[model samples]
Structure formats: structure tokens, C-alpha cells
Target: MATRIDLTLDCADARPLAAFWKTALGYVDEPPPAPFATREEWAAHFDPPEDDPDAADPAGGGAWLCDPDGVGPRLSILRVPEPKRAKNRLHMDIRVPGHGGPAERWERIGAESRRLVAAGGRVVTEFEGHHVVMADPEGNEFCVAAAPA
Candidate 1:
């Protein structure tokens, strides 16, 4: 039988990234999330529909943000206790150039990355090969891998 699952990405600030990816991908975060002033207030009202107080806060589970109308996969930016270890275990690879190659797209992405850095994102590394690895403000490593040169 086939099964479906939500994709979870780990990050330190799920709140901001939720908004970022929303604009970046044309996806939408499900509404502003039912508000609560404190965790205890949240805990009392945010339980799942299954009816269990010992259960988790289903609405705010793991930093979730979703694709608009389920066009793409839902991105769940789960929080992690430690910083990112090495390269991405599952980085997003975008094939740019459409026809030009990695080298060709370098300048374009380079400028974009520069703006991103100026805006506070840090370039973990930019490779001559075909990829540029970067950390967002909250420090998640997603990459912009170009087409082969």
C-alpha cells in the first residue's frame, strides 16, 4: 500500500523560516496559528482532535509550514538542540541555467547570495563545481546547486 508523510526540516527558528519559505515557494503557512500567551495556555487548548491532554500541541507541532493547496510537499522545520553538523543531510538542489551551465549561472546566483548575506544570511560555502551551500538567518543549510558546466 502507498503511504504519505510530511517532510520535516530542522532549524532553530521555525517561526521566521515558516514565513520565509512561504514567500520563497509561493506556499502558505496555515493561518497565524491559534494564539496563546503562554505554553501552559497553549498546552491546555492546543491538543490534537483525538482528545488527549498528555498529547502534543498538534497545531504547532515541530515548526510546520505547508504548500498552498498541497501543490508541493509540506516543509516542517523541526527544532534541534544542536547546530547543524557538516553538509545537509537532505539539502534542496535547484537546477538553474535551464540551458547555460553551473559556471554560467554563477554570477546571477552569486549576486543573489550576496544580497542574502547582506541581509544576514551567511554563505557556508560556494563551490566552483555546481552548488552554493548557505545558512539562513536561523542556520539551516539549503543549497543552490546549478546545472553542470
Candidate 2:
């Protein structure tokens, strides 16, 4: 069997970051485990200590997202006390779907970039006819590139 993996991001806040990623990646909030009606219900089962630094926020804690098509790894955004201090060693490359000439591919990349910008992402740099380096609302870097041909 193939090994499955989940991608995790540590952030000062998870809800807004997760919201931005959902729009950027076309992902949805992962449903609670079976038999649990909601995420809160599942969390209540743990009853973590109030002093536990890793505990989920009672106001609506960490956010989990999954690709709607079930093709991508699950995303787990956990809350952390410290802020991000440096660039990410690894980042996501969001490929725009298309098999076309440079001009057409650039157009597709530009469109996707614009959509992500509307979803709270900002362009860091653009390599015309190639890709655009972008940062999410929380300043995590990602790229918008043309799908491989």
C-alpha cells in the first residue's frame, strides 16, 4: 500500500489561514470523524486540560481541510504561540490546468493568480510566461504555475 501523508502548518491563527487556503486550493473543511456530529463534538471527547498549550481553542480551534476530489493530502493548520520567523523551507506550487502555448499558459496562470489575490493572497513576484510567487494572508509563500504538459 502507498503511504499517505498530511501536510501541517503552524500558525498564530488557523481559521483565517484555513479560509484563505480553502479558496486558493478549492478545498473544504474536513468532516468530523464518523459518529461525531461536528468538530466540536469530536474535540470534546478529548477534554484536554486548560493548561495544555496544544489544546484546541474553545472558540473554534485548529482548522483541517481536504481536497474535495480526494486527490490531495489533507491540510492541518494548528495554532502556535510563536509567530513565523523565517521563510518556509517547503512551499506549495498551485498549478493552473491547461495544455497550451506560452501565451495561453501565462493567461491561465494570471487568471488563477488574480482569483487567489481576491481570496487574500498577494503576488510577491511574477515570472512572465512562467509562474508567480505569492504569499498567503499569513505570509506563507506559494506559487502559481502552469500545469505540466
Q: How many clashes in each structure?
A: 0, 0
Cα-based lDDT at residue 33, candidate 1? 40
Lowest lDDT sum, 10 consecutive residues, model 2, at 52-61
Q: In candidate 2, residue 50 scores what lDDT? A: 80
lDDT of 1 by residue, 1-149 (tens): 75666777766656676665554446665444458654435546644556543355443434556666775667777655566666666666534453565456777677656665665567888786556787777776777655555
Residue 58, candidate 2: alpha-carbon lDDT = 53
lDDT of 1 at 111: 63
Give the C-alpha lDDT of model 2. Answer: 0.89
lDDT of each: 0.61, 0.89
Kindly provide the TM-score of model 1 when superposed on the true structure, using C-alpha atoms: 0.60
Which candidate achieves the best lDDT against the true structure? 2
The number of the candidate with the highest TM-score is 2
